[model samples]
Target: MSKPLFAILLGLSATGALAQTVPPPQIQVTATGIAKTSPDRVTVAYQVRGEGTTSDEATAKARDSAKAIRTGAEGLLRGDMELHASDFDIAPVRSRECNRDGYGQAQLSTGPCAILGYVVTMPVSIDTPRIADAGTLAGLIGRLGGLQVGVRGYWLSDDRPARQQAMRTALASAKAQAQLIAEGSGARLGRLLRVDDGTNRDMAIVVTGARARVTPPPPPPPAAPPIQIDLSPAPIRTNVNVTVVYAIDQ
Candidate 1:
């Protein structure tokens, strides 16, 4: 071969050898960690509904009832107890009547439709750390006329600590998994190239039980003890996912 051709061939062989000896890029591993904790707060929602012939009367009645409830709740407030009035709304109540023909068979006829009354509703929300008072509060609201009580599931007031702990665990898991993979492939795990927080955009999992609807029942027999309600909430879970990149040393 000529000198230039031989030089070119030699240069190509050297480049191929250099490429063959170079190590591959770092390995990336994704892992998830979860942490569970019990709820630390309880929230109860109440709605006061008033019905009257006129909208003004209905609104006044509802407002008065809501004010009374708020006053009572203020007295019940203790450490970490809070009361919030959410909404006040007024809407028309509708009623329909059926028209019958002389044969008594139902005929397609337009019946006299009119507004029966006006209904006003006031919504109130209460948050407290006292889980044991759920039963008493529910019963009290039931006894109060023109009030409907809705009990929401328990929740964690603060989840930052849990999330941080889960993130740590997820990172550790990713490192361990990467190490195992490296060892299996006859390589050693090197420095971390990158760590991506995959949980920042994901929402935490909050486990809640089915809501219970309770209306005041007839008075129990004198011999029967008063009823108690227990609303045990499920544990709240925080999950963290991480994508970790680590150098592989051969």
Candidate 2:
């Protein structure tokens, strides 16, 4: 080969060798951490429902039921306790004699499929910072004509502290995993280069066997004894995910 050709070949070989010897700039590890804690807040969900021959009548009945529930809940609310109405829906009620298709959609049959009435429903919730009052709230709301009254779940009013702790734990777990990987590959873990995190979110715990019994309404008599309910809920679990990048030292 000529001198110029030989020099070019030698330069290409050196470049390839250098590229092969260089290591990746960083190593990345993803980890998830979980923290379990007792709930600071208890939530009860109930619905006020009324059915009447006309829409206006149904709405009025629902309104009355809501007023009664509010009045009854007022005495139970302590500091940091709240009552909220989340949604309201009005739907037509049809006779039970209506025919149904395979999809469960109602079909007009030769028989009467006329609209029987209208039903109005409003979903309400009681959120209290005191966890012990969940059963009491459920009981009171049930007596106030609140249908489907039950403990919805247990939650944390403020999840910041739990999220922070979870993130720290996740970061530590990532570092440990990164170290293992680095050592296996004949490298050492270095400074943290970057972090991608899942933001703060609450994971509510579902309470089972905490439902309250429904009593026929007109509001219970004042002489009636208070209902006793026992509620045992599991701890809320918060999970945090993090992806961390660390510079690799060789």
Candidate 3:
């Protein structure tokens, strides 16, 4: 199920009012914390199109172009760089033969049919430990094709670690709030009832290519081992909400 925009759960005890025939006491509140860090990885995906008179020609051209990108990016991409054909299409470009009826599929004879080129795509993921070197990679990719430039996807580094740290801190803060609220009301808080993690999502930044989507190898000045997109650390977040019940020491 999709994560809710907000969540609230509460636990209470009847000892304070059940015997005396008074209403049970209840309370509610929410807490939040946010942190930011530089992204450690980037994902890039883009397409390459090639048109020819025949389907085979278009397909071949597209395949060839995609391969070229992969080759160019061989030494520039991270270890986990993925270079594969995303998609392909080969069809005739036709203007429907005018008929008495309105627009319909054009059943024209194959005399000099123009072929619509296939758009081949290549998607790549990079582990950018050195965030600063991104510009260098960009320059290399921008010139991958004659002139066509690709897109980029940048995300935080060591995401799981970051999120875990953030969640722990957030949860602690929440519990502190709960404890404070309970104490101010002269109630001794008991064990935690439950907790709900906040909305969880992965925002995938897109990456483009000069000719097609290309994940290049790490840059030449090999500062560290070939970068690998160990996605386990790319800025992931986990939220937690806990409900605690307190026994009123009457």
Candidate 4:
């Protein structure tokens, strides 16, 4: 081919290649912000476990403990606070001959699970928004049934307010960041094109009940009422994520 014709063919090929490689959909940036705020409510789960040779015996024991827990907990939770049943379970004590962790050889109960003996457990949730004395309630729960006891965690009182504030803060920060980036790159930032709200699972701060043994039986001490240790909410950190879409100006 002539030199001129060859040059024209190469130019067309280059242009075709450039057109095929379209620029990526716009650049999108996301940012997150966290806000530390006072908790609005307090929630804690109290567990009571019981065991007996027969299913009826175990169930009765659990019922008694649950009634006691509810009695003590009813007035403790605030008006707006809610009460939810945790879980009920029955497990058998295993002998070494049967299994190391559980009684694998023992006759199974008439259920879907491998249950030997009856193990009844109940959990009561306490909301501290309206309750006046938290320490008092704790002491009351500590004395119930004298069995294994545990507390899950205390979450932020109200979740909505903190989440909203965090989202606003994150969006503002993202916009500022995007604008700066666009300006420095010789481009203009456009209107927001998208938004996303993130969910949160509270991370626990304190965990109780990990001891192998308990205090020895108390001597004949004063039969004073249970020990109540009132508590107040602590500062909680909440976070929010935001994605902002801005048109890229040429």
**Of candidates 4 and 3, the better by lDDT:** 4
Lowest summed lDDT window (length 10), candidate 4: 213-222
Error of 3 at 99 (Å): 12
How does model 4 score by TM-score? Answer: 0.60
Question: Which candidate comes out best when scored by lDDT?
Answer: 2
Clashing pairs in 1: none
lDDT by residue (1-250, candidate 1, tens digit) is: 6999999999999999999999776889999989888888888888888889899999888877765655454444433467787677887655444322234453342344356679988777789878877665666566565256867768888787788788888989999999999988888999999888843544366677988645333332223232566667778888888899999876
Worst 10 residues of 1 by lDDT: 217-226
lDDT of 2 at 53: 92
lDDT of predicted model 1: 0.73
For 41-83, candidate 4 gives per-residue lDDT tens digits of 5555677777887878888988888767655555444233466
Model 1 lDDT at residue 249: 79
| Whole-model lDDT values for every prediction | 0.73, 0.80, 0.50, 0.65
lDDT of 1 at 99: 26
Backbone collisions counted per model: 0, 0, 25, 7
Relative to the true structure, candidate 2 reaches a TM of 0.69
Number of the predicted model whose TM-score against the real structure is largest: 1
Stretches of candidate 1 above 4 Å error?
1-23, 98-114, 146-148, 199-228
As for lDDT, the candidate ahead, 2 or 4, is 2
Off by over 4 Å in 2: 1-26, 90-118, 183-186, 198-225
Q: What is the alpha-carbon lDDT of model 3 when measured against the actual structure?
A: 0.50
Residue-level error in angstroms, candidate 4, position 177: 1.0
